[model samples]
Target: MSGQAAIVAHAQHWSGTPYHHRASLRGAGADCLGLIRGIWRAQCGAEPEPLPDYSPSWAEAGRDEALWQALMRHMTPAFVPADGQVLLFRLQSRALAKHLGIQCASGAQFIHACPRAGVVQAPLSAPWARRIVARFTFPAVFDRME
Candidate 1:
Protein backbone atom coordinates (compact mmCIF):
# COMPACT_ATOMS: atom_id res chain seq x y z
CA MET A 1 0.00 0.00 0.00
CA SER A 2 1.03 3.63 -0.42
CA GLY A 3 2.39 5.68 2.48
CA GLN A 4 -0.80 7.73 2.86
CA ALA A 5 -2.85 4.59 2.83
CA ALA A 6 -0.53 3.04 5.38
CA ILE A 7 -0.84 6.07 7.59
CA VAL A 8 -4.61 6.07 7.49
CA ALA A 9 -4.76 2.36 8.08
CA HIS A 10 -2.29 2.50 10.93
CA ALA A 11 -4.14 5.39 12.51
CA GLN A 12 -7.38 3.49 12.35
CA HIS A 13 -5.64 0.49 13.81
CA TRP A 14 -4.80 2.56 16.85
CA SER A 15 -8.40 2.99 17.77
CA GLY A 16 -9.12 2.21 21.44
CA THR A 17 -5.54 2.87 22.51
CA PRO A 18 -5.70 4.12 26.04
CA TYR A 19 -4.64 7.73 26.49
CA HIS A 20 -1.37 8.15 28.30
CA HIS A 21 0.63 11.34 28.41
CA ARG A 22 3.84 11.07 26.34
CA ALA A 23 3.16 7.46 25.45
CA SER A 24 2.82 6.14 21.89
CA LEU A 25 2.48 2.39 21.93
CA ARG A 26 -0.58 1.59 19.87
CA GLY A 27 -3.37 -0.38 21.57
CA ALA A 28 -1.58 0.26 24.85
CA GLY A 29 -1.42 4.01 25.30
CA ALA A 30 -1.01 7.24 23.33
CA ASP A 31 -1.65 10.88 23.89
CA CYS A 32 -2.64 13.31 21.16
CA LEU A 33 0.92 13.92 19.97
CA GLY A 34 1.72 10.28 20.51
CA LEU A 35 -1.04 9.31 18.10
CA ILE A 36 0.55 11.48 15.41
CA ARG A 37 4.01 10.15 16.21
CA GLY A 38 2.74 6.58 15.93
CA ILE A 39 1.25 7.33 12.53
CA TRP A 40 4.50 8.93 11.36
CA ARG A 41 6.58 5.95 12.46
CA ALA A 42 4.22 3.54 10.78
CA GLN A 43 4.40 5.32 7.44
CA CYS A 44 7.57 7.45 7.40
CA GLY A 45 10.06 5.46 9.48
CA ALA A 46 12.00 7.20 12.29
CA GLU A 47 10.94 10.60 13.46
CA PRO A 48 13.06 13.55 12.32
CA GLU A 49 13.58 14.66 15.91
CA PRO A 50 13.17 13.21 19.36
CA LEU A 51 10.42 14.67 21.46
CA PRO A 52 11.26 15.95 24.90
CA ASP A 53 9.16 15.13 27.91
CA TYR A 54 6.31 17.54 28.35
CA SER A 55 3.50 18.13 30.78
CA PRO A 56 -0.14 18.30 29.81
CA SER A 57 -0.17 21.98 30.70
CA TRP A 58 3.08 22.84 29.00
CA ALA A 59 1.53 25.13 26.41
CA GLU A 60 -0.44 27.08 28.94
CA ALA A 61 2.60 27.86 31.06
CA GLY A 62 4.78 29.03 28.20
CA ARG A 63 4.58 31.81 25.65
CA ASP A 64 6.40 30.01 22.88
CA GLU A 65 4.45 28.20 20.19
CA ALA A 66 6.43 25.01 20.69
CA LEU A 67 4.05 22.57 19.04
CA TRP A 68 3.37 24.83 16.07
CA GLN A 69 7.06 25.46 15.48
CA ALA A 70 7.88 21.75 15.57
CA LEU A 71 5.13 20.82 13.14
CA MET A 72 6.17 23.62 10.76
CA ARG A 73 9.61 22.06 10.51
CA HIS A 74 8.23 18.74 9.26
CA MET A 75 4.77 19.24 7.74
CA THR A 76 3.42 21.52 5.05
CA PRO A 77 0.74 24.04 5.91
CA ALA A 78 -2.52 23.51 4.03
CA PHE A 79 -4.92 26.31 3.23
CA VAL A 80 -7.83 23.94 3.69
CA PRO A 81 -8.25 20.83 5.77
CA ALA A 82 -8.73 17.44 4.15
CA ASP A 83 -8.45 13.79 4.96
CA GLY A 84 -5.13 12.96 6.61
CA GLN A 85 -4.40 16.61 7.48
CA VAL A 86 -3.06 17.33 10.93
CA LEU A 87 -5.44 19.51 12.87
CA LEU A 88 -3.93 21.89 15.42
CA PHE A 89 -6.18 23.32 18.04
CA ARG A 90 -5.95 26.22 20.45
CA LEU A 91 -8.10 24.88 23.24
CA GLN A 92 -8.30 28.14 25.12
CA SER A 93 -8.45 31.79 24.27
CA ARG A 94 -5.04 33.56 24.36
CA ALA A 95 -3.31 30.21 24.78
CA LEU A 96 -0.79 28.50 22.56
CA ALA A 97 -2.08 25.94 20.11
CA LYS A 98 -1.43 22.35 21.20
CA HIS A 99 -4.08 19.70 20.78
CA LEU A 100 -3.93 17.67 17.54
CA GLY A 101 -5.98 15.14 15.57
CA ILE A 102 -5.82 13.54 12.15
CA GLN A 103 -8.68 14.35 9.82
CA CYS A 104 -10.57 11.21 8.81
CA ALA A 105 -11.24 10.39 5.16
CA SER A 106 -14.86 11.40 5.62
CA GLY A 107 -13.78 14.95 6.59
CA ALA A 108 -16.79 15.18 8.85
CA GLN A 109 -14.96 13.11 11.48
CA PHE A 110 -11.49 13.09 13.02
CA ILE A 111 -9.53 10.56 15.03
CA HIS A 112 -7.82 11.68 18.19
CA ALA A 113 -6.57 10.40 21.52
CA CYS A 114 -8.85 12.06 23.97
CA PRO A 115 -8.05 12.18 27.66
CA ARG A 116 -11.45 10.93 28.59
CA ALA A 117 -12.24 8.75 25.60
CA GLY A 118 -8.99 7.18 24.53
CA VAL A 119 -8.40 7.02 20.78
CA VAL A 120 -11.68 7.44 18.98
CA GLN A 121 -13.32 9.00 15.95
CA ALA A 122 -15.38 12.09 16.68
CA PRO A 123 -17.52 14.43 14.67
CA LEU A 124 -15.97 17.74 13.56
CA SER A 125 -18.63 19.65 15.41
CA ALA A 126 -18.78 23.41 15.35
CA PRO A 127 -17.23 23.84 18.77
CA TRP A 128 -14.31 21.63 17.81
CA ALA A 129 -14.08 23.16 14.34
CA ARG A 130 -13.93 26.66 15.71
CA ARG A 131 -11.00 25.78 17.94
CA ILE A 132 -8.78 24.70 15.06
CA VAL A 133 -5.83 27.04 14.58
CA ALA A 134 -4.03 25.35 11.72
CA ARG A 135 -4.14 22.47 9.25
CA PHE A 136 -1.11 20.65 7.80
CA THR A 137 -0.37 17.77 5.50
CA PHE A 138 2.38 15.28 6.07
CA PRO A 139 5.34 15.42 3.69
CA ALA A 140 5.83 13.71 0.33
CA VAL A 141 3.87 10.50 -0.03
CA PHE A 142 1.35 11.33 2.65
CA ASP A 143 -0.01 14.23 0.59
CA ARG A 144 -1.12 12.02 -2.26
CA MET A 145 -4.50 10.33 -2.57
CA GLU A 146 -3.20 7.13 -4.04
Candidate 2:
Protein backbone atom coordinates (compact mmCIF):
# COMPACT_ATOMS: atom_id res chain seq x y z
CA MET A 1 0.00 0.00 0.00
CA SER A 2 1.06 3.57 -0.55
CA GLY A 3 1.56 6.05 2.27
CA GLN A 4 -1.73 7.72 1.46
CA ALA A 5 -3.65 4.46 1.66
CA ALA A 6 -2.22 3.43 5.01
CA ILE A 7 -2.69 6.89 6.40
CA VAL A 8 -6.29 7.07 5.24
CA ALA A 9 -7.00 3.69 6.76
CA HIS A 10 -5.45 4.51 10.11
CA ALA A 11 -7.08 7.90 10.30
CA GLN A 12 -10.47 6.38 9.68
CA HIS A 13 -9.88 3.75 12.32
CA TRP A 14 -9.03 6.38 14.92
CA SER A 15 -12.41 8.00 14.48
CA GLY A 16 -14.67 7.88 17.53
CA THR A 17 -11.95 6.72 19.91
CA PRO A 18 -12.53 8.59 23.14
CA TYR A 19 -9.62 10.62 24.37
CA HIS A 20 -7.86 8.96 27.28
CA HIS A 21 -4.34 9.43 28.49
CA ARG A 22 -1.89 6.76 27.35
CA ALA A 23 -4.72 4.68 25.92
CA SER A 24 -4.50 3.35 22.32
CA LEU A 25 -7.46 1.34 21.12
CA ARG A 26 -9.80 2.12 18.22
CA GLY A 27 -13.15 3.54 19.33
CA ALA A 28 -12.16 3.01 22.96
CA GLY A 29 -9.85 5.69 24.34
CA ALA A 30 -6.46 7.19 23.68
CA ASP A 31 -4.24 10.25 23.83
CA CYS A 32 -2.27 11.63 20.90
CA LEU A 33 0.52 9.15 21.52
CA GLY A 34 -1.92 6.32 22.01
CA LEU A 35 -3.62 7.21 18.76
CA ILE A 36 -0.30 6.99 16.98
CA ARG A 37 0.36 3.65 18.61
CA GLY A 38 -2.98 2.30 17.45
CA ILE A 39 -2.32 3.52 13.92
CA TRP A 40 1.09 1.90 13.91
CA ARG A 41 -0.36 -1.34 15.15
CA ALA A 42 -2.92 -1.43 12.39
CA GLN A 43 -0.34 -0.54 9.78
CA CYS A 44 2.78 -2.33 10.99
CA GLY A 45 1.76 -5.00 13.47
CA ALA A 46 3.44 -3.74 16.71
CA GLU A 47 5.06 -0.62 18.03
CA PRO A 48 8.72 -0.43 17.11
CA GLU A 49 9.69 0.49 20.68
CA PRO A 50 8.29 0.73 24.15
CA LEU A 51 6.63 3.98 25.21
CA PRO A 52 7.82 5.96 28.21
CA ASP A 53 5.51 6.78 31.06
CA TYR A 54 5.19 10.52 31.00
CA SER A 55 3.77 13.15 33.28
CA PRO A 56 1.60 15.83 31.75
CA SER A 57 4.69 17.99 31.80
CA TRP A 58 6.66 15.16 30.26
CA ALA A 59 10.28 16.36 29.97
CA GLU A 60 9.57 19.75 31.53
CA ALA A 61 11.52 18.29 34.45
CA GLY A 62 14.60 17.99 32.24
CA ARG A 63 14.12 20.12 29.09
CA ASP A 64 14.46 17.15 26.80
CA GLU A 65 12.33 16.54 23.72
CA ALA A 66 11.51 12.98 24.69
CA LEU A 67 8.51 12.62 22.41
CA TRP A 68 10.38 14.15 19.51
CA GLN A 69 13.34 11.92 20.16
CA ALA A 70 11.16 8.86 20.36
CA LEU A 71 9.53 9.56 17.01
CA MET A 72 12.87 10.09 15.32
CA ARG A 73 14.20 6.92 16.89
CA HIS A 74 11.30 4.73 15.82
CA MET A 75 9.62 6.34 12.80
CA THR A 76 10.47 7.80 9.44
CA PRO A 77 10.62 11.58 9.26
CA ALA A 78 8.80 13.71 6.70
CA PHE A 79 9.92 17.32 6.36
CA VAL A 80 7.50 18.14 3.58
CA PRO A 81 3.74 17.85 3.34
CA ALA A 82 2.65 14.42 2.21
CA ASP A 83 -0.53 12.43 2.41
CA GLY A 84 -0.62 9.85 5.21
CA GLN A 85 2.18 11.56 7.11
CA VAL A 86 2.13 11.75 10.90
CA LEU A 87 2.30 15.25 12.34
CA LEU A 88 3.34 16.59 15.71
CA PHE A 89 2.39 20.04 16.80
CA ARG A 90 2.70 22.42 19.72
CA LEU A 91 -0.56 24.12 20.58
CA GLN A 92 1.50 27.20 21.30
CA SER A 93 4.82 28.39 20.01
CA ARG A 94 6.23 28.55 23.54
CA ALA A 95 4.85 25.26 24.82
CA LEU A 96 5.95 21.66 24.60
CA ALA A 97 4.79 20.39 21.22
CA LYS A 98 2.89 17.31 22.35
CA HIS A 99 0.06 16.86 19.91
CA LEU A 100 0.02 14.25 17.14
CA GLY A 101 -2.08 13.71 14.01
CA ILE A 102 -2.07 12.13 10.57
CA GLN A 103 -2.37 13.77 7.16
CA CYS A 104 -5.36 12.87 5.02
CA ALA A 105 -7.36 13.86 1.94
CA SER A 106 -4.70 15.47 -0.23
CA GLY A 107 -2.77 16.94 2.68
CA ALA A 108 -5.40 19.58 3.19
CA GLN A 109 -6.75 17.89 6.31
CA PHE A 110 -5.76 15.56 9.12
CA ILE A 111 -7.20 13.19 11.68
CA HIS A 112 -6.01 13.47 15.24
CA ALA A 113 -6.81 12.37 18.74
CA CYS A 114 -7.66 15.33 20.90
CA PRO A 115 -8.78 15.93 24.48
CA ARG A 116 -11.78 17.84 23.24
CA ALA A 117 -12.97 15.75 20.32
CA GLY A 118 -11.30 12.40 20.57
CA VAL A 119 -10.17 11.35 17.10
CA VAL A 120 -11.53 13.36 14.20
CA GLN A 121 -10.61 14.71 10.80
CA ALA A 122 -10.08 18.43 10.89
CA PRO A 123 -9.07 20.96 8.30
CA LEU A 124 -5.44 22.00 8.30
CA SER A 125 -6.26 25.61 8.84
CA ALA A 126 -3.54 28.25 8.71
CA PRO A 127 -3.27 28.48 12.49
CA TRP A 128 -3.06 24.72 12.85
CA ALA A 129 -0.66 24.34 9.95
CA ARG A 130 1.67 26.92 11.39
CA ARG A 131 1.77 24.99 14.65
CA ILE A 132 3.18 21.88 13.04
CA VAL A 133 6.61 21.02 14.43
CA ALA A 134 7.45 17.74 12.79
CA ARG A 135 6.03 15.13 10.42
CA PHE A 136 6.64 11.40 9.96
CA THR A 137 5.52 8.59 7.71
CA PHE A 138 5.31 4.86 7.97
CA PRO A 139 8.33 3.08 6.57
CA ALA A 140 8.07 1.62 3.08
CA VAL A 141 8.63 -1.88 4.36
CA PHE A 142 5.70 -1.61 6.73
CA ASP A 143 3.22 -1.48 3.87
CA ARG A 144 2.75 -4.88 2.28
CA MET A 145 1.84 -3.48 -1.11
CA GLU A 146 4.56 -0.89 -1.23
Candidate 3:
Protein backbone atom coordinates (compact mmCIF):
# COMPACT_ATOMS: atom_id res chain seq x y z
CA MET A 1 0.00 0.00 0.00
CA SER A 2 2.89 2.34 -0.61
CA GLY A 3 2.52 5.30 -2.94
CA GLN A 4 4.18 3.43 -5.75
CA ALA A 5 1.89 0.43 -5.54
CA ALA A 6 -1.25 2.56 -5.30
CA ILE A 7 -0.14 4.73 -8.20
CA VAL A 8 0.56 1.68 -10.32
CA ALA A 9 -2.97 0.53 -9.60
CA HIS A 10 -4.34 3.96 -10.51
CA ALA A 11 -2.26 4.06 -13.65
CA GLN A 12 -3.67 0.71 -14.69
CA HIS A 13 -7.19 2.06 -14.30
CA TRP A 14 -6.39 4.74 -16.87
CA SER A 15 -4.96 2.48 -19.52
CA GLY A 16 -6.62 2.89 -22.92
CA THR A 17 -8.48 6.10 -22.05
CA PRO A 18 -8.33 8.24 -25.16
CA TYR A 19 -7.08 11.79 -25.03
CA HIS A 20 -9.69 14.54 -24.97
CA HIS A 21 -9.46 18.11 -23.88
CA ARG A 22 -11.24 18.62 -20.55
CA ALA A 23 -12.70 15.13 -20.66
CA SER A 24 -12.45 12.44 -17.98
CA LEU A 25 -14.06 9.16 -18.94
CA ARG A 26 -12.31 5.82 -18.73
CA GLY A 27 -11.71 4.03 -22.08
CA ALA A 28 -13.39 6.86 -23.93
CA GLY A 29 -11.87 10.29 -23.42
CA ALA A 30 -9.94 12.07 -20.69
CA ASP A 31 -7.33 14.70 -20.36
CA CYS A 32 -4.64 14.48 -17.69
CA LEU A 33 -6.80 15.97 -14.94
CA GLY A 34 -9.64 13.72 -15.94
CA LEU A 35 -7.45 10.68 -15.61
CA ILE A 36 -6.32 11.75 -12.17
CA ARG A 37 -9.88 12.50 -11.09
CA GLY A 38 -11.04 9.11 -12.33
CA ILE A 39 -8.36 7.30 -10.37
CA TRP A 40 -9.03 9.45 -7.34
CA ARG A 41 -12.58 8.13 -7.30
CA ALA A 42 -11.48 4.54 -7.84
CA GLN A 43 -9.19 4.59 -4.83
CA CYS A 44 -10.75 7.15 -2.50
CA GLY A 45 -14.41 6.25 -3.20
CA ALA A 46 -15.36 9.89 -3.80
CA GLU A 47 -14.06 13.18 -5.12
CA PRO A 48 -13.48 15.66 -2.33
CA GLU A 49 -15.06 18.49 -4.32
CA PRO A 50 -15.97 19.53 -7.79
CA LEU A 51 -13.30 20.98 -10.03
CA PRO A 52 -14.24 24.24 -11.69
CA ASP A 53 -13.96 24.34 -15.45
CA TYR A 54 -10.69 25.84 -16.52
CA SER A 55 -8.97 27.16 -19.58
CA PRO A 56 -5.25 26.46 -20.01
CA SER A 57 -4.71 30.16 -19.43
CA TRP A 58 -6.09 29.74 -15.93
CA ALA A 59 -2.52 28.90 -15.00
CA GLU A 60 -1.42 32.34 -16.19
CA ALA A 61 -4.08 34.36 -14.43
CA GLY A 62 -2.42 36.85 -12.06
CA ARG A 63 -2.94 34.67 -8.97
CA ASP A 64 -2.59 31.25 -10.46
CA GLU A 65 -1.79 29.02 -7.51
CA ALA A 66 -5.35 27.72 -7.62
CA LEU A 67 -4.54 24.15 -8.53
CA TRP A 68 -1.65 23.90 -6.09
CA GLN A 69 -3.82 25.33 -3.35
CA ALA A 70 -6.46 22.75 -4.14
CA LEU A 71 -3.94 19.93 -3.82
CA MET A 72 -2.61 21.30 -0.59
CA ARG A 73 -6.08 21.27 0.89
CA HIS A 74 -6.79 17.67 -0.07
CA MET A 75 -4.01 15.26 -1.11
CA THR A 76 -1.21 14.38 1.25
CA PRO A 77 2.16 15.57 0.03
CA ALA A 78 4.78 12.91 -0.62
CA PHE A 79 8.54 13.12 -0.67
CA VAL A 80 10.03 13.44 -4.10
CA PRO A 81 10.92 9.99 -5.43
CA ALA A 82 11.64 8.32 -8.72
CA ASP A 83 8.95 5.78 -7.97
CA GLY A 84 5.27 6.09 -8.76
CA GLN A 85 3.54 9.01 -7.01
CA VAL A 86 1.41 12.00 -7.97
CA LEU A 87 3.48 14.87 -9.41
CA LEU A 88 2.80 18.52 -10.05
CA PHE A 89 4.99 20.76 -12.16
CA ARG A 90 5.47 24.47 -12.66
CA LEU A 91 5.22 25.28 -16.33
CA GLN A 92 7.15 28.48 -15.75
CA SER A 93 9.21 29.66 -12.83
CA ARG A 94 7.12 32.79 -12.22
CA ALA A 95 3.82 31.05 -12.83
CA LEU A 96 1.57 28.97 -10.62
CA ALA A 97 2.18 25.24 -11.09
CA LYS A 98 -0.48 23.66 -13.32
CA HIS A 99 0.50 20.30 -14.77
CA LEU A 100 0.24 16.82 -13.28
CA GLY A 101 1.40 13.25 -13.91
CA ILE A 102 2.23 10.03 -12.12
CA GLN A 103 5.81 9.01 -11.51
CA CYS A 104 6.41 5.49 -12.73
CA ALA A 105 8.84 2.61 -12.48
CA SER A 106 11.81 3.30 -10.28
CA GLY A 107 11.45 7.02 -11.01
CA ALA A 108 13.01 6.43 -14.42
CA GLN A 109 9.78 7.17 -16.21
CA PHE A 110 6.32 8.76 -15.84
CA ILE A 111 2.93 8.47 -17.43
CA HIS A 112 1.27 11.75 -18.33
CA ALA A 113 -1.38 12.86 -20.73
CA CYS A 114 0.18 15.05 -23.35
CA PRO A 115 -0.98 16.48 -26.65
CA ARG A 116 1.25 14.07 -28.52
CA ALA A 117 0.77 11.08 -26.27
CA GLY A 118 -2.48 10.29 -24.59
CA VAL A 119 -0.79 8.34 -21.86
CA VAL A 120 2.61 6.87 -22.57
CA GLN A 121 5.64 6.17 -20.44
CA ALA A 122 8.60 8.44 -21.02
CA PRO A 123 12.03 8.70 -19.49
CA LEU A 124 12.39 11.19 -16.63
CA SER A 125 15.03 13.03 -18.61
CA ALA A 126 16.54 16.41 -17.78
CA PRO A 127 13.87 18.61 -19.38
CA TRP A 128 11.04 16.72 -17.72
CA ALA A 129 12.93 16.51 -14.46
CA ARG A 130 13.53 20.24 -14.48
CA ARG A 131 9.84 21.03 -14.59
CA ILE A 132 8.84 18.94 -11.59
CA VAL A 133 7.91 21.10 -8.59
CA ALA A 134 6.00 18.96 -6.10
CA ARG A 135 5.07 15.38 -5.20
CA PHE A 136 1.99 14.05 -3.42
CA THR A 137 0.78 10.75 -2.06
CA PHE A 138 -2.72 9.38 -2.32
CA PRO A 139 -4.69 9.45 0.92
CA ALA A 140 -3.33 7.05 3.55
CA VAL A 141 -6.87 5.75 3.93
CA PHE A 142 -6.48 4.35 0.43
CA ASP A 143 -3.26 2.63 1.41
CA ARG A 144 -5.05 0.89 4.27
CA MET A 145 -7.77 -0.24 1.86
CA GLU A 146 -5.19 -1.85 -0.38
Q: Over the stretch 10-96, how does candidate 3's per-residue lDDT look in tens digits?
A: 676676677787887777887777777777777777789888867654246457577788888888787758465778887776776
> What overall lDDT, based on C-alpha atoms, would model 1 receive against the true structure?
0.83
- Among all windows of ten consecutive residues in candidate 3, which has the lowest summed lDDT? 137-146
Over 29-66, each residue of candidate 1 has an lDDT whose tens digit, in order, gives: 99999999988876666788989766786248568888
Give TM-scores for every candidate, taking all chains together and pairing residue i with residue i.
Answer: 0.89, 0.87, 0.85
Q: In model 3, which regions exceed 4 Å deviation?
A: 1-3, 57-61, 141-146
The root-mean-square deviation over C-alpha atoms between each candidate and the true structure, in angstroms, is 3.0, 2.8, 2.6
Instruction: Give the distance in Å from residue 7's predicted Cα in candidate 2 to where it truly belongs.
Output: 2.1
For residue 66, model 3's alpha carbon misses the true position, in angstroms, by 0.9
Candidate 1: where is the Cα deviation over 4 Å?
1-5, 58-61, 142-146
User: What would the C-alpha RMSD of candidate 2 be, to one decimal place?
Assistant: 2.8
Candidate 2: list runs displaced more than 4 Å.
56-62, 141-146
TM-score of 3: 0.85
Residue by residue across 1-146, what tens digits does model 2's lDDT show? 66668667767877888888889878789887887787777667768887778754422434567788888887888877888888988775566778888888888998887778888899999998998999987765365321
